[model samples]
Target: MDRQTLDMEGARRGEISSASLQMGEDTIAVQCIATMSVESMEFSPWETATNKRAQSLYASFFVINLFFGLMALAWGGLFPGNGSSFIALVIGGVLTLLGFVLGIRAAMMARRMKRRQPYYRLVIGASDGRRIPLVDNNRDVLMRIRDVVRHKMDSGDREIRGDFDLDLDLVNLNLPTEAQKAQTLSRGPDIVPKSRQRETEVEAATAETESEVLFDQDAEIIRDAS
Candidate 1:
């Protein structure tokens, strides 16, 4: 019969849709949100790519080249008088440079992949018990939920309730996915082809010329009548 009961009924049917957080008379206290932070978690170097085998192969190349190059250099240093010492030095230097370049490439790729991933977390501390946690990948969705709960808290709502969906491990963070980027590009303003634009200009020019000729003919007939 009251507002609380109505909200509860709506929640039961999943009509109240937003992030996973639910706030109402039976939910956790919004004031319990003691800390809020945006964080990032890195994907493992091996697990960061669609092509796992390629990633593994590159890593192997880095290790193998570096190891062999160092060994060859050591051999050259220990046997300077040997006939092959100069050859060993040359091969070692080239291989070492190649290995170093590969290692740098791997490091840069890892950093880039990490930048594409992000996490949004909310921590709530209960006055009477353990802390509660809510995590989501969508920054906008999470912020909206937080604002709603905070509004209720600021308005002196003591009987606050909060619900969270803890199964968020499979959810990915908000980023411009390749598909989304392509979709956005597709929505850009339509551009007229150059040929079509040229045709329109020519039609306007012809219309203007015809109008000028008609005006000249009317003037000549008026003069002859005078």
Candidate 2:
């Protein structure tokens, strides 16, 4: 929806917290409450149509079993000469009973699962690369989120929380003590340009000396030839 509609709705609800929303003179602004505060969530009816299908399928199970039971009864009546027909009737009755019971249970479970919104639980104790359940009432989850947000704002570190799975490296930074900061500053770079220049000069001098020695040997050969 457009901002004007949002603002009008917010105004009706009286939630405009003195917050100025800048829009053109012709435009309107809408202030909305945090999404979590919305009491009942809205969803498309199409999303729930699948549930109706499951319910219908569950309801049909009984009808199907009843029809099969009637068929078994008819077969037993038609074959007075065969004792096996009577045995088949008993087996069908047993299966029909079992199907009805299981079908009812499945219907109840589906409705229960649908009504209960699936929640992700993070169990801190039994954490095995999946859930890490914080305190029972989602308090731990909120607290962790708050702490993580605070940690990022203070430290300016962009590392993902998952990186610290094996080690609680983020939690240890209680307050980079003054001494620790000083110690970090104390370490200096080893290779100054002056030291590197001196080493290069020494190497050049050694190469020059070798060149002169070779020149002297050449001069001796020339002297003997002459």
Task: Judge candidate 1 at residue 150 and give its lDDT.
Answer: 62
* Cα TM-score of candidate 2: 0.32
Mind giving the per-residue lDDT tens digits that candidate 1 earns over 1-226? 0011111111221112222333323344345545444343322323433534454566778888999999889989999999999899889888888888877876655554444334455544555564444445555655654565565556754333333332332222232345587888989988899999999999999999999999999999999999
Using all chains and alpha carbons, the TM-scores for the candidates as numbered come to 0.33, 0.32
Error of 1 at 117 (Å): 4.2
Candidate 2 per-residue lDDT over residues 53-138, each given as its tens digit: 66667667767776777677677778858978888678678757866775786577465545522222222221123222221122
Q: What is the lDDT of candidate 2?
A: 0.44
lDDT of 1 at 128: 51
Clashes of 2: 5
Per-candidate total of colliding backbone pairs: 5, 5
